[model samples]
Target: MYIATYIIDIAALIYLMGLLYSNAALNTSRKKPFLIAIILTIVIILSEAGTVLTNNGSLNLRGINIVCNVLGFILTPMIPIAITLIFSRMILTTHKLLLISTFINIVATALSPIFGFIFYVDANNQYIRGDYFFVFIIVYIINLLILVIITLEVGKTNNYPIIGKLVGLSIFTIIGTSIQIVYPFTYSSWHCVTLSLLLYFF
Candidate 1:
């Protein structure tokens, strides 16, 4: 049943491999944030894979399952926050606000193992959403919206000719994640994210 998820994970891995071997010099301040975004994507991918494997009974390591779920919930929002940092010229206040929101999510997710506020793993090693799952959804959406807005703002400030490309990438990300949100069994969000990162790098 998770064959599609596994395939998407492999595709993301290939995408990362191509990026690493492309000889792209990530020396600029802007490019540095892009690198960070890529790294966060890698972490999220691993966390997601671990969660899927454990949830499917392929792995019985409950401790690892809990850790993976925690990592996935906490780190998913940080990707967009890192994307926001790609725009060094963005307002400092906006940066602070985004950071604050991410911090709140980190705290909430970190404490959720005991509190079960965001998610928890059951005795059968099944992943379960908590009452505050909406918190994660809202934060993810807000950060994505901010990412789109910041990209537009920066593209206009610099008069970038590829603003349409940026918008296209943002729309792709939105659609990809929305599908996964509506159908939790699907595993396309990170793959879409990986594709977006590849497009952004070019």
Candidate 2:
């Protein structure tokens, strides 16, 4: 199942990248955020693959695992946030806020190895819950809620064609994050995001 999901995710990211690359016809308003999502998706795939590939039982490989895990933890939440911003009324002007949010996670992840506050890899190279595990869910949930609210607000004009699909993204992200929070071993969050993007474009 892991291998299948990994392959699906990488394939989805590659397809999305290609779709967006030559998409000169993408809605001009949403095109920038869409491109940003593609870039972040690539970052996420690399980080996810790194975590999967480097988890041998050796202490030397632990560094790679830790680094990859930290990168994953940081990139994981950004996916939904980026997707939400793409569907919402957000633009480049509001990116500083996203940067601040990402910076907070980056700091917590950087501190996790020492303090185990954000996330930590066990001696077995497994993800051990940290003090701030719920923090990821909270951030994701808040972003999802904000995305939903914006979708509804845009719906007020009766011109928001993608409201339902955006809401689906919200629901999928919420469920995926919830499952991942309860069962850290499942790797559900990234998969959910990939599925959501597929729905968004298709």
Root-mean-square deviation (CA) per prediction: 2.7, 2.7
Q: What is the C-alpha lDDT of each candidate?
A: 0.78, 0.71
Candidate achieving the largest lDDT: 1
Q: What lDDT tens digits, residue by residue, belong to model 1 across residues 1-202?
A: 5556656665665666566556467556766677678777778888888887777474457778999989988889878767677765453564566666767788889998899889988787778898998888888888888888888888899999998998888888888988987898788888788878877767
Model 1 misses residue 26 by how many Å? 5.0
Cα lDDT, model 2, residue 91: 30
TM-score to native of every candidate shown: 0.86, 0.83
Worst 10 contiguous positions by lDDT, candidate 2: 90-99
Candidate 1: which pairs clash? none
Kindly list the per-residue Cα lDDT of model 2 for residues 1-202, writing each as its tens digit. Answer: 6767777887887888788767877776566676677667767767767777776567768888888788777776676656666656553365446446556777888889888987788787766768886666566566566666666766666777777766777787678767866776677777777777767776
TM-score of 1: 0.86
Off by over 4 Å in 2: 89-102, 122-126
